[model samples]
Target: MTRAVVLVTGPDQLALWQPLLTGTERTSAAPVVLRRHDRRSLRGWAQRVEMFHKEDRLERLHELTGGWPLLVDQAHRLHTELDDPDEVLRRLAGLRTDLTRAREFADAAGVYADPLLAAGYRELDKEFADGSFDWENTVTAVALGGELEEDDAHRVIACLDALQVFDRDGVELRLEPLLRECVTLRT
Candidate 1:
């Protein structure tokens, strides 16, 4: 007899997998969600692909993609196709802008359709609207807002976590670079 573990990956959308994996199935399969790369890991990925970019340019690429593997691969492809580095960044910026707009539209539609989701979005939007927040302060504000019950707050936080909205550093949490960019652009 042989034992093996299989890995499956798909879009970040959890709703897509809900129907396929029931409680028992999920318990047996034990799905493990993978997060996007950080700056260091993304740099390693670029090196593996034989893509060498200057530090500043690479930093910008990380900012644009939030180290998402697919977007990083797209950036690599664009870099190979374009002769000018500046042009590559410019093109990536345009693509990121389009993606951000599409996400905004989708989020708006979702908020309109679901009250709980709307509350989460509102809390997030209000927190990050100023482009700065102390993690503790933000959490306190959300908990004390009086609009969201404790369970609702937990759900909202879990939903945002599933969406990869925050990067955790030790005890602190902050928005991922790309999400911060989107918030900045919105304001």
Candidate 2:
């Protein structure tokens, strides 16, 4: 059997690099040439990644960001116009508390109600913390600022999906514990 070296050049190049690394057992290459980019070529590279990058990016996102609540909270906004027929906020908050209490979260800055709170993979502050809120309390609170009907609530999730804040399935948002606290924000 001969060695096959695959060289991928681009941002979001993880996909190309993934198969090369994951299947390295099969493909014999002396240090594959996986050329990626920095901030300079970020946008273009991201486009390429989107074309080829699959669950790797999302999984990486989850792994880096502690859990999916950051993703889900980042995705949807509170619709304060209508009534929350589904009580999404309540469900989501419960989820956040659970993820936090379970020690599932990494050690994140400015997030623990007590030092006991595990801020799993908190290096992802830029991802979920980028929201307009101040902290987790505020981020989670943002959802409670408004009342939303089922359709409007879904629309919030949809908007988040479009932004890539959550996956197409919104699994990050669907987690049982987090979904239970979707209604507690007031500002």
- Cα lDDT over the full model 2: 0.30
lDDT of 1 at 73: 72
TM-score of each: 0.67, 0.19
State residue 101's C-alpha deviation in candidate 2, in Å: 32
Kindly provide the TM-score of model 1 when superposed on the true structure, using C-alpha atoms. Answer: 0.67
Give candidate 1 misplaced runs (Cα > 4 Å). Answer: 1-29, 95-115, 128-146, 183-187
Please report how far candidate 2 places residue 146 from its true position, in Å: 1.7
Provide the lDDT at 100 for model 2.
54
Best by TM-score: 1
Runs with alpha carbons beyond 4 Å of true place in candidate 2: 1-145, 167-170, 174-187
Model 1, span 49-163: residue lDDT tens: 7664678887887877777665677778887897666777777677446756646633432332345544564566677653555555555556666376665465555555545
